[model samples]
Target: MELPVVKYNRSHYIETDTGNKVSRKSVIYGSQNITLSGKTIIQAGCVIRGDLRRAGGGQTLVIAIGRYCLLGENSVIRPPHKTYKGVFSYYPMKIGDYVAIGENSIVEAANIGNHVQIGKNCIIGRFAIIKDGCRIEDHTVIAPNTVIPSFSVYSGSPGRLVGELPECAPEMYEARSKEFYSKFMAT
Candidate 1:
C-alpha cells in the first residue's frame, strides 16, 4: 500500500544518524532500557515505558524495537510483567524489523515478529506472541498469552484468526514500511 506524504515540524523531532526520527513530544521513560535498532520512527505523544524492568536484575533491556519500525502517534509500548514462580518480573518485549504499529494503540506483547502490522486503537495483551507476516486489524483486542501464527490475519475483540496472507507478505510489508519511512518528511 502506498502511503501519502506525512510532514512534521522539523524542530519538534530529533533525526538520528541511523535515520531514526524521534518526536520530542513523546514520553520515553527509562530510555536506557529501550533499544531502537535503526531507522525507527517514534511519533508524538507516544509513551515507551522502559522503566518496567525485570526483578533481581540490573538495568537490562526491556523493550527492543527493531530496524525500520514505526510507532505511531499516541501509542504506548510497554513491557509485559507477571509473577512467575513467586518472582514478579517484567519480561522483555521484542518487535522485529519492518513492523508498523498504528496510532492510539497499546501493546504489551512479549514478541512481535518481522513484517507485522498492528492497526489503530488495538490492544495487544501482555505476553501475547505475534509471529512473522501477521496483521492485526483495527480495534482488535488480543487476548493475553495468545500466540498468533505466521502469515495470518487476526481481527475482532478476541483477535481470532481471520485469514491467511500470501507468501510474499514479508516483501510487501517491508516495502511499505521503507516507503513510509522515506516519505516521512519534515516541513
Candidate 2:
C-alpha cells in the first residue's frame, strides 16, 4: 500500500520528502534544512526552525531527527541562537531512534539516547546528556551540561536521580516504542 503525500511551502535550500507526514499547521521556514525518513510525523503546531540566526539571513541550521521518533504536540527542537549567550553554540540536538518527547518540552541539548521518554513541560538544557532507557518525568528540569547515564529514572525540578525504575520503566518505554513503530512508523 502506497502512503498519502503532503507538501508545504519552504524557502530556498530546504528539502522535505513525501516520506514524512507533516501537518498543514506546522510552520517550517524555507531557510532551514531538514532530512526526515521512515514514518516521521511533524504534528500540528510543531515548529522546527532550521534557521538559527534570530536576525535572519544566515547559514541554515541543520536538524536531523532519526527514524521511529515521536515529537509530541508543540515540542520545539532547534539549535540555540546567539541572542541567548547562555545557550550559544548548542547545536545538533541529536535524538536517537524510538524516542518520545512530550508536549511543550524544550530541548536545546547535545544528545538524547534511544528509547528515552521525556515528559511534558520538561526542560532539557544545553549539553545535557540523557542516556539510553531513561525516563524523564513531567515538569522535570535537567540542568545544563549534566550527564544522565543509561538506565535511570529522572524526575523533579532541577532533575536528579531518584532511583532505578524497578526494572519496569525501561520495559514500558520499549513497549511505547513498539507502539509508535506500529501506529506511526511502517504505515
Which portions of model 2 miss their true places by more than 4 Å?
1-19, 30-32, 53-61, 81-90, 166-172, 184-187
Q: What is the RMSD, in Å, between candidate 1 and the native fold over all Cα?
A: 1.0
For 1-187, candidate 2 gives per-residue lDDT tens digits of: 2333323343211224634556666666532466564555666667776765334455553666766677777888775434365654435566776788888888876788877888999998877888888889899999988899888888999898987655566667666655654554221
Q: TM per model?
A: 0.97, 0.73
lDDT tens string, model 1, 13-32? Answer: 99988889999999999899
Looking at candidate 1, the ten consecutive residues that score lowest on lDDT are 53-62
The per-model lDDT (C-alpha) reads 0.95, 0.69
Poorly placed runs, candidate 1 (over 4 Å): none
**Which pairs in model 2 have colliding backbones?**
11-30
Estimate the Cα RMSD of every predicted model relative to the unseen true structure. 1.0, 6.6
Best by TM-score: 1
Candidate 1, position 112, lDDT: 99
